[model samples]
Each structure stands twice: as C-alpha cells, then as structure tokens.
Target: MKYVVGLLLALACLQAQATEEQTVVLISIDGFRHDYIELHGAPNIAKIAEQGVRSEGLIPVYPSKTFPNHISIVTGQYPSNHGIVDNNFYDTERKQRYKMGDGVKDSTWLTTLPIWNLAEFQGVKAATFFWPESEARINGRTPSYYFNYSTPAPNRQRIDQIVEWLKLPEAARPRLVTGYFSIVDTMGHRFGPESHQVAKAVKHVDELIGELWQRIHDETEVPVNLILVSDHGMSQITAKDMIDVKELNIDEELFEIVNASTRLMIYPKEDVSADQIQQLEQRLKQKQGNFVIESEQQLAQLGVTDGPRKPAIVLGTTAPATFTTRPEEQRKDGGTHGFHSSRDMDGLFVAAGPAIQQGTQINRFSNIHIYPFMAKLLELELMTEIDGDAEVLTPIIR
Candidate 1:
C-alpha cells in the first residue's frame, strides 16, 4: 500500500511539471508599432509591459512586410534565407509566382524549420490561429491544430478559440499556440496611422488582448507564458507621393518588374545588354530624387543578394514617396511599411510568464531573436540551423 501511494505521488508531480513546461502562447498584432502603447493608451498591452517584459522597440527585418517578418520570427531566419523575401514575388528560377491573398500552401518555399516543427517533433502539441505559414506543412509537418487563413477572423472569436484550446486536457492541449490580429494594419492602410480610425482599431485590439489575458488567468492553472509581437510598423503615404514607373515607358521586354511600391525590384531579361541596364536605371531615376538605388553590397545589409529572382537594381524611397508601375494602385490617405530598416519603423514586443523577467525593458531587439527565446521556454530542441542567436535574448528571459 505504501509503495503504490508513493508511485501515485511521483506520477502526479511529473504530470504537473510537464504541464508547466508546455504552456506558451504567441500572439501577433500586425503592424503594431512600438509607439501605439503610448499613442493609443493600450492598457492591456501596457499591463504586460508593467508586470512582465517589454522591449523599448522591436526592430523588424528589412523590407518589413507582413509575411516575411512573421515567418522570420518563428523560423529564426531572414526573409532571403527563408525564401519569402516579399509579400509577393516572382521566382524566376522556379517559374512560380507568390502573391499574398492567394494561398501560399506550398512548403518547398520555406528554407528553414519553424517553431511548430520542433514542437511536433518533440511530442509537444502545437496550435496556430492564422500565423503566417501555419497552414502549410513544412517538411511534412504542420501545427497540430491550425486554422486556415482567410478574411480576418473576428478578434473575439480568435480569443475565444484560444481560451478553448487552453482548457483542453493536458494530452490534447497545445503546448505552443500562435495567433494573429490584422485590425491595426488594416486600419493603418485605410487611414493614416495617426487617423482616428487607427486609434479605434488600437482600442479594439486592446480590448481583445484584455479578454485573452483574463481568460488565461481565469481558466488555466498550468503556468502560461504569453508573448505578443508584431510583424512591422506603418508609415503614412498618399497617392500623390507614388512615383509612376510606367511614365518612363521602359521596354517591358528588357526586364520584368517583380515588385514595386515603396520598394522596387526588377529582374533583367537574360539577354539584356549592359547599355540597356544603364538606360533602365536612368529612366527609373529620371525625376525622383527620393529614390536610393541599392547595390549588391547594400542588399547584404537587408540579408539579401542579387540573384535571378532578386532585383538587379533595388530602389528604396523615402517615407510618403513610393515607386509603383500600376497607375491605378494609389491611396489618397493611407499608411505603408516595407521601407528601409533605418526608418525607425519598429514593431512591439511584450511578454509575460514564469520564464520572462518582470518589469524588464530591453532597449531594442531584433525579431529573429524571438524564435530561440520561444524554443527555450517550451523546452523544445531546434532541429535546423537558423540566423537567430539565442544569447542575444538572454536578458529578457529567465
């Protein structure tokens, strides 16, 4: 009788330890600029900063687009390394085109393994609610539970779903969960970041965040780690600021404009002459002093290089000015990102849990570092090499 009782107590302690080691929730708020917490009085977000850890600012990877940065956060790799260099790009080598709205279901595009892969491989259940690349099976493995991305799911609905997932039995519950909210980015694009619409959107997100916080505290006895992150920041722009590249009337046969607007990347035709390339450069910069042409050496700063799919001549513009080939693609009063990383367009990062340091503030940190930080919290071993260094995030975590 004494031996049986001792065995029962040991089993209970082991189960409790497992539960504590496996509770991590990763939430992404699209376009969550670091200033929004103060600009909009984001109380719920502020709470995390006050009680847990908050970075002074979280710098995004270059190009600072949605999909790329989000994927980078989880994969611990740069967009160039992961192969999702832009929200939309034409793969010259594979003859494949990747567009954001259209389903990017193919996993071959990803060059590194994501956090979900590690979780699943270690027998830890993982779930995702609209995180980029969550729906696709990378290396024949997807999150244990993932929702298909569509038009933004209701914020309350997403929070409710997460709460339900947390309430499940330990064996079935997700040890690592990822979620997304696009309202801030949507409002930022429709109206400028300073507009009242953006404030309202920020408030809405704050409420949803509060709801999640309350639910987690109320429902879970297992120690939970909550991490809220954003892909990039937004910059105000206008239709009048857009430089019409088509006005140059350059021959489309000589090069294909792979991506444009804010940043322009062009792939030259195989047989294009050096003179033609120079002419194309002259035409692109004909009237724009805001354009800064990027060289192969400069592209390395953004973790990219010149390749068949990569633009031979990369053009970056100042805030409020952009390059676009489509005349109709204009916004009278809106916001945009994907500018140079030096523009100070940093995202937000807040974390709270047993592993996170309380009332700690990191002056600034890179988004790629979040991957190894998360892996450590969940006790999962990363199986692939990545760009992130675990040592950089040591200050933020216990």
Candidate 2:
C-alpha cells in the first residue's frame, strides 16, 4: 500500500514537470520590410516561411512607432487601448513628455496585461531578450528573465544565450523566449531599404535566425514553437527632398515636431488657431510633394490618428518622400516611419511550429488581430479584442 501511494505521488510530480517544459520562441526583427524577407539575405526566414504560414504584410498600429505597436502585438490591443500611442508625446495626465526609455514611470503606466503576465499566472516561465517594455515590471515584476535593449551586442551572442537557457532542466526551463534585432531597420534608415547596407543587415539577421534554428534542434526537442514578427516597416527618405520645419512659419506654439519622414507627428500647443493653420500650410516654404500636412481631423480619418498622447496634427511624407524639423542634424542615417501603414509600409510575420499549419498563407490577418492567435499559441486567456481576427490562420500544422 505504501509503495503504491508513493508511486502515485511521484507520477503526479512527473506530469506537472512535463507540462511546464512546453516552450515557445518569438522573435521580432524591427523595421523588417515585408518584401525583404524573400530577397537578398533572408534564406532561413524563407525556409521557415516555406514550412509555415505568413501574412503578405503585417499591418502596424496607428502612429506605428516601436513601443505602442510592440505592446499591442503581444497584448492584443491598439495603442489607444494599450496606453502607448507613439514614441514621444505629451501625456495629459502627467502633463509631460513620455518616451519608451523612461524605465520606472512608463512601466507603471501600462494598463493592459501582457502575455508574459498571463503566462506567469499559468505557472509557466517566460523570458525575453531585449523586447521593448519587457524590462518594465508591472503588477510586481517583469518576465522570469529579460535583457534591456542592447543592439550593441553581436546577434550571435543573443542566440547563444537563448541556447544556454534551453539547457536547464525541464522543470526549471522557461516555456517562452523572445528575441529582437535592430540591424535591418537600422541599415534601412541609414542606407534605404534598397541599399547594399540593408542587404547586409538582412543577411546578418538571417544568419542569426539560422543559427538559432540549428541550435534549438541540436540541443532539444522539448515541444518548442517559434513565431517571428515585426513591429513596422521602413520607408526611405531621400536627402534632396528633406523638408525643414524650422524654415516654415508654422505655429511654433501650436505644435511640437516629434519625428519626421513619410510621416511626421505634430503635438498642438495649449491653444492654437484654424486660420493660423491655413497660413502655415500656405506659407509652408518648399517644393510641393515635399510633405503633406494633415489637420487633426484628417489624421483621425486616415487611421494614422492617435490619442491623447497624440498631437493635434500630423505631417506625412508621400511615398519615397521624407521630412524633418531639422534636416541637417537628424543624422546621415536619418529615416522615419509613423506613416498610415498603407500597402507601401506593410510589416511582416511568420509562424513555423506545431501550433501552426505548414506551407499555408493567411491572406486576411491584420496588425491588430495577431494577439488572439498568440493567445491560442500560448494557451493563455485573451486580454483585449484582437483587431487581427479578420481570419484565423490555418497553417503551420497538420
């Protein structure tokens, strides 16, 4: 009788341990253009794509800057709902500047729950490698483990660290791991998406992906899954067309320039005028097509519209066009996003694993709807309405 009772207890413990080892790896290549995956140097990603399902382009959130879109991707919420609308904005509540790098204060401001929080609640260990806001602890603390944003480290080193984590015993193993790299986006902004430097960046990220794929298989078969996605895409802004806001008679008080490119954001001063706005547009010195300025209402209609953190007006550079407040000082690699995320600026996503069907393409996925799918992948409860529910992906699995 004693032996039977002991055996029963041992079996229960073993079952619990096995359940804890189910692993998922999610990687994000920032600013990875949708078209770039199949070209130049992304063969590994291509291999993954061939084996799984992918969206033609992963649409980004409004003001599709880094922080908001990233939180939305994982939490399944829009910037408005998720609390991060753009890179920099005037916080009405705090009535001050808000940037993603403000570690302590910003972390507390995240209202919606993230997948990491959900996974932890499920008794699953989740870890992240340099994901935006991942280091910020909410409720109590961050993921089981995480690294702050550090693009300076060699990409291969990040892969090595992930492999190291996999070596832990199943009971202690983290069930989910996320990684990120900025080289492709960095190169695109500097040399344009079509430039040779961008190609090199593509190759570098691809090689790292290949190394990770090889390492995971070579090390363990612990029922691991992989999801690759990007926050936004890059648009090249030529120097000859760069517009300097400083030269324009726009209300210095009516708005503050955040960042410029095909899309420029303008935060209105405390009090402004409509006729004054017209004058600024008329006197706006420069060649036309240099950049198009949009009123607050117009921006709201385009879906590029933002919320309280958003400015009253937005300036958008058309395709292949760019703008800046100070073109001379923005940096040689000076580039921009925050566009309407039209077909021209589509993002990227790929899922290759047991959780998804193989060799499938889902035509109708949107940037907002990816969260529900992730909820399905992690077996976690959904926190917000996934805008990406146009059609659930039916690939990457049997």
In model 1, the runs with Cα more than 4 Å from the true position are 1-19, 101-103, 273-275, 282-288, 325-331
Tell me how candidate 2 scores on lDDT: 0.71
How high a TM-score does candidate 2 get? 0.84
Candidate 1 lands at a TM-score of 0.91
For candidate 2, lDDT tens digit of each residue in 91-186?
Answer: 644657777766445575676777787788778788888887888887676889788777688788889888887778877778778888888888
Clashing pairs for predicted structure model 1, backbone only: none
**What C-alpha lDDT do the candidate models reach, one value each?**
0.82, 0.71
Among the numbered candidates, top TM-score falls to 1
The deviation in Å at residue 27 for candidate 1 is: 0.5
- How many residue pairs collide in each prediction? 0, 14
Q: Write the per-residue lDDT of candidate 1 for residues 1-398, one digit (tens) a residue.
A: 99999999987875665456758899999988889988977998999778899987888987888988998999999888877888887777875777773334677877778898888999999999998878888889888899998765777889999999999998899989999999999999889788889899999999999989988989877678899999998899877777777775657787777655778777676688888888878776675577778776878977886554576677888789877655565347589888877434799999987667889888778899999988988887888888899888877775
Q: Which whole-number lDDT from 0 to 100 does residue 204 have in model 2?
A: 86
State every prediction's TM-score relative to the real structure: 0.91, 0.84
